[model samples]
Target: MSVIKELARIINEGVNTIQSKCDASGKPFPSLDEPYTPESDAVRIQVIADALPIIAAANQLIATLQIPAMSIIVASGYVHVSAAFATIAKANVVEALREAGPQGLHVKEIVEKIKKPMDPAKLARMLRICATYHIFREVAPDVFTNNRISSLLDKGKPLKEILAKPLEAFDESPGCAAFVDILIDESFKAAAVTQDHLMDPSTAFSDEPNQLPIQRAMHTNKALFEWYDEPGNELRRRRFNIAMKESVKFEVPGAILQGFDWGALPKGSKVVDVGGGIGGTTMALYDIHKHLRYVIQDREAVIKQAQQVWQTERPEALENDTLALQPHNFFEKQPVKDASVFLLRTVIHDWSDRYARTILTHLRAAAAPYTQLVLVDQVAPLACSEDGISDVPGATAPTAPPPLLPNFGLAGSMVYNLDIQMILLCGGEERTVLKISQLLSSAGWKLQRIARVPGNLLHKIIATPA
Candidate 1:
């Protein structure tokens, strides 16, 4: 059979496996609105694993089998990539129509309701594009409504919330909005000139914060945090906090809770949330492991805010001193010494090799001989070899089945994008398990274990003092 035909057969088999798994459990196939829950999520994971081969094979087959016209369309994807951000900026349009409900609104009516006036003709093209991408529904010409995906982008729920309020009431609770803003405001501009940074020897070789692509692109020597802390950057800092809070959704903090044997630690053991913002991840885990005492540490500004969060959401833990908020910077020596665990979620990836080493070194200094340091972030697969193994040190990544890309291909798209985000925004890059192990060793720690969070992209790099 031809390659396409074979791919089709593979897809059919994968679909059958998925359907069979669902049927055996006697549950409806998961929907976008109501996906598989914790109790019923295992089958979904299995089904996806079963289908990875078919899906990746289909992707490769389709690309290889494309006609000249289709290849040209692929060649012009840069336009589409550029336009995607433009479309996100036009999120207000989607929000206005979403407020109008599923019935949607006429182009002219939506044009007026939005904060900024948009031309009806131009709005039509935007809506048409969104509709083409299955974001909005064009039930009839010029009337658009929200579908499953667009609803997530609606105001107050996600990106729209932070963007809607750029300055006021800004103490960093917003997430999706702030993150989207970061992408549009700083990262996008820097991404456009990334090649320029690479080609320039000074900028390319330098991992110093002020010398990176983003610094050059924006014509500033301030590093990302430095820029956020500058005078007149209150709004920027607040949005960053909001974005960090929202990151809990993506980081899969629950994985750390379940992935680790927290119960193994003695009751009332300490867990220092290094660089914790608002104690969000700690709060989640605290709910499950109530026996442990926790300290949420960060810079003074956010530590103050985190106390307020603890007071409001978890007053008992705060009142009883079971959960404490401390103002401590990770760059300095850790203050809560000899803690049972040091948890840094989405922190290490934000720094370069030298910086990451420093952060680890500081943690190592404060850590007791028995203390475990948890580095929670994405563990990038350095490369996928023909054998389907990742070239990572001190650990192993899950191998994809035959006919599947070694690292799950499109399913791993966000990982690849985030790896670049590390470089574009900061002079950092995601590391393989091996790289992480090397870093840990240099910081006077040994790689103990790697824990995977089910249904999430983040990994737990557990280490101990050497």
Candidate 2:
């Protein structure tokens, strides 16, 4: 079959599958016109095992059919889209529209509700561009309403509450809004100077965290995390903490249970979450396997925040010593020598191989003979098909059928985008499985297996002492 025909067939099959599933559940497939809710069944169905290929194929078809010049132009202009999104999200336009109801409200009314001064005409144009991309709905000439995509920015607070405490706007959010804000604000600024950072002799060849594009952009010598903890960056630090917790929303429900068997561990086995920001991973694990003891290690400030969270969410865990929030840096020697499992979720990718290996080696030194190390991060695949490194003992990544780029092209672009974002913010890069295996091996750990966290690009890599 021709490329276009094949793409159409894949999309058709996917739509049928989705419709049939929804019908079986006695609920209609969700409409873009409706506002988003986390409890909606639509999210669950979309992330099931079978829906991934269809989603990839559909995205690839659009990219394949678009005029090449137009596609590039549109891609280049995404900065504007992000900027507009940040503006609306920050100004609480989503909350305003939520109050206005489905009929929508005039752009002027939205501005008035937000209590922020913005030109109505300019705001309309911003919403219009976003609407063209299906983010919001331009119900009338200068009126806008929240749609499925736009409503995801709602922080679940009243307009007055959000406006009165602008700094605390994202506290009640699901993290999407904060994530978008960070991407467009700091990440965007850092990404803009990527070319300059890459070409400058002083920084081009450096792998030091302090020499990253963010440093150049923000004129700071401190590394990204250090910079966030600076006195003047309190708001950014809080938003980042919220965004990190929100990262789990991208995963399928019960994703942490997919790979390694937590039940197999001996009763009361200690699980050390290294560099675990605010104990998100540990909290997820504790929810399922309260039989196990948990220790969450991070910077001192983050540990304090994690303490606050535990006080509110699970005070008993703290009181009973079932979960401990310890302020420890992974770059230093591991402190929990008796840990049965060392969990690194989205941690290793924040550093280059040299730094990553160092962190892993510390854990290796502290690990008991039977300690299992679980590294949860994105395993980037090549754009074309080829047998991966033979030395690793895990299933290779699946490739797409003919005409689609082997890595599923734009459908699988999140990992790539994150790779660049890592580079821009810190001297880090997303690694291929082979690279990860090598890093593990250098740290005296053997790659045991790899498992996908269904619905997302993240992989659970299990390793053990070499």
lDDT of each: 0.73, 0.85
Number of the top-ranking candidate, with TM-score as the measure: 2
lDDT of 1 by residue, 211-296 (tens): 77788787888988778777787776766776776677544435667667898999989999988887778887888889999998
Q: What is the TM-score of each candidate against the true structure?
A: 0.87, 0.96
On the 0 to 100 scale, the lDDT of residue 128 in model 1 is 75
Model 1 alpha-carbon drift over 4 Å, by segment: 24-27, 30-48, 68-91, 157-177, 251-253, 386-394
Q: Lowest-lDDT window of 10 residues in candidate 1?
A: 385-394
Q: After superposition, how far is residue 132 of candidate 1 from its true place, in Å?
A: 2.6
TM-score of 2: 0.96
Instruction: Give lDDT: candidate 2, residue 205.
Output: 87
